[model samples]
Target chain A: MSKYAELFATESRDHLTAMEHALLELESAPADRSALDALFRSVHTLKGMGGAMGYGTVSTLSHAMESLLDRVRSGQESLTPPSIETLLQATDALASAVAASTTGRESALDISTLLTRLAVPAAPAQGTTRVLQIVLDPGTPLPGARAQLIVGRLARVAEIVRVEPDVAGMESAQFTGEFTVQLRSAEAIEVLGDAARAAGFVSSLVEVVPRDEVRQTPLSVDATWNTGDLQAPLQKYVRIESRRLDGLMDLVGELVTMRDRLQVVASRHGDPALDEAVAKAGRLIGELQDGVIGSRLVPVWQVFDRFPRVVREAARAAGKEAVLVVEGREIELDRSLLEQVADPLVHLLRNAVDHGIEPADARVRGGKAVEGRVLLMARRERNSVVVVVADDGRGVDRQRVLAKARRLGWVTDDTEMLSDDEVLRIIARPGFSTAEQVSEVSGRGVGIDAVLAKVRGLGGAVEFSSVEGKGTVFQLRLPVTLAIIPAIIAQVGAESYALPLTHISETVQPAAGALRRVQGRPVFVLRGQVLPLYSLRALVGAAGRDPEGQQIVIVEATDRRAAVLVDRLVGQQDIVVKSFDLVRGMSAGFSGAAILPDGTAALILDAGGLL
Target chain B: MSRQLLVVSVAETLYALPSELVREITTLPSQVTRLPGAEPSIRGLINVRGQLFPVMDLCHRLRGVPGNEAVDVLVVVSDGKTLGLLVDDVRDVIPMDEPAASVTAPDEADTSVVRGVGHSGEMVVIELDVPKLVRSSLA
Candidate 1:
């Protein structure tokens, strides 16, 4: 496909997302006029774009949606729930059509069901009229002829019910460059605009007064108003393909590394001019890196926007009434992280609706409100974002969970009262579900474990708190970005390793007597807690014993805390993580490699693996 | 199309990697950070121009005798990653007029590393299969 076609596909997907959000908003607030206008404009632009790209199916479907939206905008038709669903389904079809176009394949999706739904008959013409004010380019050689051509084009799309200055006067070539052509068409304003543009030499299109709005206030037909300010999206931001943004970020990372190298060289030479130049470059590089990384951040609402619909469907299927309240949607996260976390968040929300929420009759019997509430909130903490999915319904039954754990042989009878940590661990084990019967939505014994694995893979953690009668709140703490992170470099043997500081609690110089043995396993008592101790040297298969004065770095994974013994603690620094292909025979202990300031490679240890 | 190859030796075996894949050649660096849990064939990681990449010990990878003498590092690109291959010594770069066809190897290990065997007159040069070697090293 041509580059332009590729660009159209990307832009069309963005537009589709906007349309979906607007349609959802319209469903919640049927009388929201601004949302209706935005929805109409999105479909209008999509139609034009698809038509230009020769995507006949997408354009045709969008055109049908625009017509129905026109009726709703004019107050001739109302937006029902079924109508909203039809519009959403149509948008999905358009998205697939856009994808097909990118691959140079004709869209074979049968959108006839959607097209029939969107083909709502237009209201009869009731004398309401739209005054379209068209201005021709001043540089056109023959302004009068251009006006005639435009009027002829407008006549083809709509009825030329009223032409200012008289049709005979226009034919006589006595008018200026601009003329007001009053149109009376049941078609949306977008169709008329297309027709006007199809005629040459038009510079501007103003929907001076829509048909329904003009009905309320009678203005002189000759009096024209500029309504071009009502355009959607306002052209305030430029749309850039994310791949180009990634390329920019990669270049910035390379620049930062080069700047570090320059700083090292400058310090050695002790040249004042060189030092000044290097310092300036360093500051500029820092600012550029921030800007590049900032551009890659998008509001979390992009993912949160789809949850309300998910909750509605899941609640309906489960025979319950649940309301999803989303907060902190404006919080921004790395775009790639947002995409990665979307599915996991959806699964958690489904788990809440499917399992945590009780049916309506059961809720009243349990002395709770009939409607269940699921609150999805995101907030920033230090260097990570914590998203919590809290449901106020039937909380987890600890007894049932313990019984299931016993049945699965995950814990023996000797296991004491299971703490919340132990409970979370058991739930996170694959194929460990307390659900009595597998439901279609979730809880097939495959969800929570997958959620744990995915979150951990992205350098995040998940935990939950449940009260017998109150509710359950699942919290996911995730790093803001993955490219660059602060890591504590430590020596395992003769080799240096970097550990993500997100998981490190502290480094302690353990006294000799602090060491103890529990069940033939090494353990260290820190602050009266017997923390499992593992030597990094032994874990990495290194030779020799750890030197005296070795420090135990306490690290936290999911629900467990452990101490990793290292020879020495190197100071912390922000390092760029570079991914490499791990050979088949290699161990999976290390996450990836990082380049230290001294121009050497340090394997960044995966903190979870240490546990 | 004519192609250039960089010939290097590990122990007594001769190997050649396509020159396009070889980014540069430098004397082994003094500080090669050893990755303790990495595959035995991966000697360590060497930092080149602020970028750190895994260095594979060709002698061990090719199942040849370990050489104690100084080795030169051949930094090459494979699967979009930069890797350094340590060889006993660097030989001359030779041009081949046409593509070399594969010859049946005496064993599976030799076939896995050698894409084809090229004859530079009487000297037999084992053409290194760069992608397969890197994939196996990472695997």
Candidate 2:
């Protein structure tokens, strides 16, 4: 595809998505005028674009769909289920045609059936009158001829209800380039603008819509306003490829290392002037690093926008009624991290709709609304973003889950009651599900284990809870960013390792007797709790450590708190984490590799694995 | 096919790799963080500029002979990923007009890296498959 074709394809896909969304809304509320307006506007834009691109098939199909929507908007025809279905199918065909056009191929799709179904004549065109106030450039030759051409262009789309000047008056020299042409048509103002421009130079054209229509038109951000700014997005937002941003990030990291080296060199020189300049360089480099990282952040709405449709589809497939409520879409996160989290969120939402939400009959019998609700929310907590997927459906059947767990030997048969934590553990086991054993989940969707692995693989944690006869809630806590993070550096023997500050609760110097053995497992007594203690020597195979002074860092991960002992606390600083997965057969615990301030590399520790 | 070869030595055994795969050859950095539990052939990691690369002791890896005299590091890229091969000393680069002869010996332990042998003015040089060598070493 040419660069222009790529832009066209992307924009056409966006409009198609919007039309689908508006169709779903109309399906739920047929009387919703705003949804109808949005639907009409998107179809109108698609038609205009398709026509400009020379794709006759796409333009023709979109034009028919636009006519139908315009009829509904002007009170000529009401939206029916059959008409909505036809609109949806037509949108799909339009998308296919657009995609095919990008590859320089003609779409083989037979849109005749869809076009015929959409082109039924309206029952009488009631109250569809619009006035076009036209103006031509001043001191132009053949002004009367220009006026005639404008009227002739508009006469094709609408009935010539009225015209200000008679034929003689227009032909005579007394006629200025200004005139009013009142036409009756069920079309958007953009279509008329296109027709007017097709004739000759139109200096100015305004649609004087009826009084009620004007009030509902929403002068700002409505159909008419968006048409004026159709070319604005391309001129407004510069589209830089993501790989370029990644390259800039790498260069900034290199600059940071250079600044560190310069600072060391400046200190060795002991010259005051060079020292001041190096200090200033260091500050500027720090700010530049922050700016580069900030550029990689995008709002969560980019991922959240596609989820409502997912919920609706899943609900329809399961023969249930479910509505998705979203919150906190404006929160920002690392672009890569946000994208990686999208699939897991999709799985949880589908799971909630299929499992947590009861059927319409069950909901009605339970004294609840017939339409179930699933809430997806994102909120900032400390250095992490906590996302929640909750539904007001039948809660998990714990008895069935416990029986299945016992049968699989995941939990002991003699165990009477399993806590919420135990239940989550059992269900998230790799091969935990069966055709016979289902809680709220019917074991028909993506395995919960895969979801858990994906979230945890990104250095995130998951929380699960269910109350019988109520509903289920799943919380996924993820880091705001992964490429750069603040970490605590700890030394063991001659090796230095970084532990991210997100997982470290505090560091403590345990007293001589505070460290004791419980059942031969080393445990630290911190505030009356026996937290498991792991020594750096055993974990990383450090030859030996100083027994005289031992510092323990308390780490909390996946509901397990543990104390890790190291030789000494070196310091804390922000480090850029680089992907180290290229090295296969390496030990399983290290998360990534980062360059230290001293120009050496240190492995970043993984909390989920360590604890 | 004509090709440019970079020759290096590990424990007195000479080896030649395609020059196109070689990124650079430099002295081992002062700070090499030791990964204690890794394979015996795996020495540790080295930070070149700001990127961390896993440095392997080539002598111990291919010949089972420890690299006691190894000092130079050859940084090579394969499939967009990089690995550092630690060798003994700087060697010469040779231009060949003919391809190396394929060696298929049943007694060879590592067939991944040493797939053929070549000659350079009466001296024998083992032609190395850099991509397979990287994969075998990592595996």
Q: Per-residue lDDT tens digits of candidate 2, residues A338-447?
A: 99999889988888887788889999999999999999999999888899899998977888889988888877779888777777878788777644545443355567
Among the numbered candidates, top TM-score falls to: 2
Candidate whose DockQ is highest: 1
Which ranges of candidate 2 are over 4 A from the true structure? A1-236, A257-280, A434-446, B97-112
DockQ of 1: 0.45
| Local accuracy of candidate 1 as per-residue lDDT tens digits, B16-129 | 888999889987778887766676778777777656777888877776444456479898888787778889899989875443655744543446767887767677788888
Clashing pairs in 2: none
Q: Model 1: clashing residue pairs? A: A582-B138, A583-B138, A583-B139, A584-B138, A584-B139, A585-B139
